[model samples]
Target: MVLTAPSPKIRRSATKVALVVGSVLNLINQGAAILGPADISWVHVALNFFVPFCVSSYSAARN
Candidate 1:
């Protein structure tokens, strides 16, 4: 038996969606830093940004 790969359109759409979602998460984290509680720790906020995950997604899309 053999399986066929998804078409280019579908693959691009999926990657775009993944990138957008990752961007939204990063944006939300940044916005929280600007408008959220003053007592929030810098370390915690930095972690919330999820930079590594977003970067990995971007790299994947680029390839």
Candidate 2:
């Protein structure tokens, strides 16, 4: 079996996802400082999960 490299599009998508996740986490941390952990909402949970899920799915499907 031959090993291949990921395509540019996939790389870009993954990087973008990483950036977005970082930014979101930063906001969450900031909010938590003021509001505490119990303030997490369903929308935040869904975005934290499904955003990464879709990015991973896109990369895997392309490969």
Q: How high is the CA lDDT of each candidate model? A: 0.52, 0.59
lDDT of 2 at 27: 70
Screening candidate 1 with a backbone cut-off below 3 angstroms (N, C-alpha, C), the clashing residue pairs are none
lDDT of 1 by residue, 32-62 (tens): 6567764545674555444544454455555
User: What are the clash counts of all predictions, listed in order?
Assistant: 0, 0
Model 1: how far residue 57 lies from native, Å? 14
Please give the lDDT score at residue 28 for candidate 2. Answer: 71
RMSD of 1: 8.6
* Model 2 local distance difference test score: 0.59
State the lDDT of candidate 2 residue by residue for 1-63, as single tens digits: 012225565556666776677458647755764367555565666566557646664755556
